[model samples]
Target: MLRRTGIPLLALAVFAGPALAGCGGGEPEESAADLLSRAKTTLDDASSAHFVLDSEGAPNSGTLLVGGEGDIARPASFEGTLNVRALGSTLDLEVVSVDGTVYAQLPFASGFSVVDPAQFGFGDPGALLDPDTGISQLLAEAENAELGEERRVDGDVVREVTAELPGDLVEQILASQDPSQAVQARFSIATETGELRRAELTGPFFTAEDDATYTVELSDFGADVEITAPPTG
Candidate 1:
């Protein structure tokens, strides 16, 4: 999802982190198209699943409990709630897995603002993991792909694939660019099953001394889920 700062570098990293961290393939002379296509296939085969969204971004880091249900047959949603501490106090942000719909009720803000998860824009779990309208189009946006080393996830070794951003994605990210700076977005996927594990966001979002890396751990499933709109004025 979109990073706090308007910096494209930071935004691209955070948004593309999933593809960068988990999206990879088994050892082989594989093309970028083949790897991405396979990743999409794995996601297409998933009926239901869950993960924890742990983000190391501005403000603080915490686990975002998430779970999903239904596949291509029935439409369902993954829902989660998290207690986030920013400044000196704590606020709750409710993340909905229906498309990119995220409802955040902050103490300072008037109320929840239904945000388009796409604002994060690198095929967030809400969309990529959805049974409908998944990473097919999003994959087309990739310009390059490379298979990295095997890593341990969930105690199992898995291949990591890094997908470089195409010109369109770069343009989309650079739309808000500053002449003084520039950056690229990458998407990593799991080589074995294409499940998104972690996402990292880095770049000029913060000052030279500030930390720009962010990680979101995508858990907490099998319970009943509901996403009611935040109360309005």
Candidate 2:
């Protein structure tokens, strides 16, 4: 049993630093729409990036660490380690998407199995930002957005923005093949470069008594990386 109340993900921002004004800008800064729009443009322009995802609470009820470098464009692919929570161990997992097909490297009797994507908790990794219902589109759908304190992270000023998300937006970010919950996300962006540093998403995707939260950290934004298909056994 858990309390219905817990620290909202944004609460982490308070520890950033003394409250400070927005980042220095001569253009009076842009609206969330414009800023995110440009950031989306930047992300869309990128061919690949390295990413890590940490999530917990109701739905999973266990800690999960999944990360790897992959292409951001359609036919997305990623090679990384997925800690086998049940076994209390970690294993290498490779995910690939070419055209519209998505597949994963699963375990098969001391060997590896190239199976469908569903078993790995993903419906379509490549379409996560499909320009229609992707993260960029989710930000485009953001409402009640308010800027929060600006603080320095690794010497770069990061700005926080909170907003309520529509159901579809919430589901789209889910790591599972199934997602049917309304969501809200706290966004952290780089003030100087308009780069998205982190995103914390909260939603009621688990059950009535509990909620789900996903913390996604995106880094190495424009690294040149190629995630190709694994060898056939």
* Best prediction by lDDT: 2
Query: For each candidate, C-alpha RMSD in Å?
Result: 19.7, 15.5
Candidate 1 local lDDT, residue 131 = 38
Give the range of the ten consecutive residues with the poorest summed lDDT in model 2.
58-67
Instruction: Compose the digit string of candidate 1's lDDT tens values, residues 1-233.
Output: 56546688877899899887666754556565776676556555555445443333343332221122221211344455544444444455554545345554445677666655433322233443443454334454544556666677667445555554433333232111222333233345565556544433343332333434433433222234444435644
For candidate 1, the clash count comes to 26
Q: Report the number of clashing residue pairs per model.
A: 26, 0
Report how far off residue 152 is in candidate 2 (Å).
Answer: 2.4
Query: Each candidate: what lDDT?
Result: 0.44, 0.60
TM-score of 2: 0.71
Model 2, residue 70: distance off in Å is: 5.6
User: How many clashing pairs in candidate 2?
Assistant: 0
**Backbone clashes in model 2, listed as residue pairs:** none
lDDT at 62 for candidate 2? 38
